[model samples]
Target: MNRFKAGEHEGVTWVRGIAGWSNFSIKVFLYLVDGVLIDTGPVKLSGILVPFLEQQKIETVLLTHYHEDHSGNAPYLAGREIPVYINAISLERCRVKTRLPWYRKVFWGNREAFSPYPLDEKLTTDSLTFKPVSTPGHVFDHRSFYLPDKGFFFTGDLFVTTHPQMVLNTESTPRMIEDLKTVLRYDFSTVFCGHAGIIHRGREVLQKKLDYLEDIQGKVLHLHNRGLSVSQITRKLFPGRLHLEYLSCREWSAEHMVRSLLTGKATAENPRPRT
Candidate 1:
């Protein structure tokens, strides 16, 4: 079943992809503003999106990252001769057609190989100009688009939830905190999150996310100094997160958070997971 919804906001059209059967199922959003389409939704939902794009005059496509859910339709758009802009690293990754995990393949589908044009620091349209901000931590090549004039921040996967129960094996909690802080310095009142939709109070939401990660990091460091193992600290910090760990097949767990805090490195034993 194809499930999706479109909403208009001050000339920006947001297309949201419904991932699963639940009403509150995780979703991915693609935004179109000023003839510029930001982030293409997953390939699985292209049946609806392709026609939707045909109705609009999209001059260019800008990707927040090369994550399948975000960049799956790049090849389709590029085939139309529409210039698709993504960071160099993300472009390279996409060119290689990186293999995704089973869960990602099932939910977002595979990203068809695409050749994306390199994005410059600034992307400008007739009515709007977006400044690409390097906000890593979610992924090394992740970026957030900021429209200073409108006070809008298109945060890719950065502020998914104020209180995230799990961090991917590749995520660095500390780096995420820094990136959150880095973006906070900008003047933005609204946040267009990749999964959570629009956040009216963008700064406040980002601050809350930063505080949560910093608090967790502090606790993990304190417990580590006390000679507590990662598992022990995880149990103390997140007691009820075991269900989430089980659901994600341990790909996302408190241990990932602990490992990020202790070493700032991803868990080497586990295969790299997507955000």
Candidate 2:
């Protein structure tokens, strides 16, 4: 339930998320420029977020994506029709995709307490403007909020503050590469992620992640071509002989990537995890 206010920006002030939850905690940013609260953390911890928010002069909520750990407090926020803004695709995922067993498990109880969250307007702002980079892969609707003026990026779950993995349960390895490439073009000073810890040398780390992922792809392809099952290769490439523990931490779902390798479609939906 810790809250840390960031250095002032002319237009926006950031309320950064604290560190603690394995993947449960993140440094969520409340862009205080327009008084918009970006993402609301877990619902069960309403006392943690809502009361903290009550002390602020907030205008609305602009959810980055819909992971329950990230969006857990939506119900409590829905006490009134607070104008919550999010990507359209993310909104759909919240409503439909999250109901699947995989999604349900990831979100805990957000799907069950389903109430119509009041969303005022979809983000039609220019992608380049506001530094809002559409960095999906962790989830299809994921968006990375960038403050170009402030030289910061709320990377969400896109970038792992911890060690990177090729576990294959998560969907974004390839997409992460793309995101890294695109976001790297920006001169961001710091990158805040959902878990692990805040990263200062984010640009360099992002390049390293990209290099690692590219290398993993080649290895995964070679192993797959050699008739190794996805799990076999996943283990070998990840937690197996590599000592790359937590390569598939909640921040990244390596299992999904492996399934995509196995069946050519690595979509995770609350079904019994393949491995």
Candidate 3:
């Protein structure tokens, strides 16, 4: 099943795309400012999202990452010759089809390959100028857009929650911590998140997330110094496994989180037991 909802804050218009069963569904958001659209929801919600976009006078599209959930409809816009911009590092990644796990395909659907422009310099629309900042952590090529004039930050999956329990095996908590620190140094009053929608007290919440991550990182390192294996550290820190771990066939797990902190690297697709 698919559902769509729209809202506005200040002058920015936002839309939510809900896909899958109500119990296990996930919500993704897209925002529009001036004539620019930030993120393209996912392929699963294209029926609703495409229609919604047809009604808006969109000019340019800004992608936060190459993840399907964020850039699923990029081809749709590119077919019409709209300028779609993504991080230069991820430009090549989007040039080919993206392979996904069964769970992701069921939730967000597969993303078709599309050519997108590189975001090297500042981007501007009618009235707003966007400063593209590299905030690699959630993904190697992730980015966040800062509207200096409005003091608004459009973070894709950077600040989903203050305390994230489970993350993809490819995620690196150490990098995420650095990304958080990087964004925290910037001045932003409102945050437009791809998953959590708009956050008015964005800076305060991001600071709390940073503090929590730092605390977790310290504890993980301390446990490692004590000769604890990744599994042991995960059990001590995160305790029991989350349902998403099984749902994603361990692609999303607390163990990966611990492993990333200990090794400061992303685990493999099929991460072997550390101990």
Candidate 4:
């Protein structure tokens, strides 16, 4: 069974849900602001989500990206003729069903294909307007919504945690650092994270995340300069084997960070160290 809780902030309602059985299961949140839904929860908990959405006067859905957890319920809304907006790249990726890892398929479920409306630079409702900020790193088409007037930022998977030990094979630490720096130039007081929920000190947390990644990159580079291999640096920096590495069958691991720092790529295969 799934579990969820809802919280309200002024005109916005934040729905936090656990996609599966455990409390430590993948947590995802959907935000509703002034009749606009920021993201839809994963398909695993559609029974709860579909009903909750039915009670809202949701005018449109502004997807942060095409990740399975974020776009899972988009097809449902589209069936109701509710326009679901997404970045062009994400729309193209979601137009066809993509096979996912067995773990992801079980935890977050697979996202069905859906036609997404092209997202604009700015989206407006009767009471609020949101500006889409391209903040890729977690994924190529990732975006964060900034409500300039309200000082709120809906960051999808951008700040899951300031110090994530394991990163997906598709994630780029360098690009993520750059995106964090870019978003910092904006003025936002609170961040509505995709999984962590609302954060009042969003800027501080983002800065910390930037600092942590840069620090790791610096360490990785220093070790590489000293003739250390990616494995050696991973052991020195991370110290112990992360359970996620084993769980993901090494698809995601601390070595990925070292590889990303040394080669500027975040793939499962490690590249030769810089000379």
> Quick one: best lDDT, which candidate?
3
lDDT of 4 at 73: 94
lDDT per residue (tens digit) for residues 1-275 in model 2: 54554555445455554534334443554444455566676543454556667776665666666766567666556555665656665444454424333423533444323343434333333322344678766666677877765687777677763345443344545676677888888888777665534677888887787777677778888998999886788777766433223432333445556655455443653223122
- What lDDT, from 0 to 1, does candidate 4 have? 0.84
Per-residue C-alpha lDDT of model 4 across residues 1-275, encoded as one tens digit per residue = 44868889866799988875433477799999987899998888898888988888888999998778999999999889999999976666777665777777777778788899888679987777899999878777789999998999999989999998878876778888998998999998899999999999999999999999999988888889999998999999998886667766887788877788878766743222111
How much is 246 displaced in model 3, in angstroms? Answer: 1.0
Candidate 1 on 179-217: residue-level lDDT in tens?
999999998899999999988988999999999899888
lDDT value, candidate 1, whole model = 0.83
lDDT tens digits, residue span 125-172, model 3: 768899988887887778999999999999999999999988887688
Using alpha carbons, what is the TM-score of model 1?
Answer: 0.92
Query: Of models 1 and 3, which has the larger lDDT?
Result: 3
Model 3: weakest 10-residue lDDT segment is 266-275
TM-scores for all predictions = 0.92, 0.71, 0.94, 0.92
Model 1, poorest ten-residue lDDT window?
A: 266-275
Determine which window of 10 residues in candidate 2 has minimal summed lDDT. 242-251
Instruction: Arrange candidates, best lDDT first.
Output: 3, 4, 1, 2
What is the Cα-based lDDT of residue 180 in candidate 3?
Answer: 91
Model 1: residues >4 Å from true position, as ranges? 21-24, 242-244, 268-275
For TM-score, the strongest prediction is 3
CA lDDT, every model vs. true structure: 0.83, 0.58, 0.88, 0.84
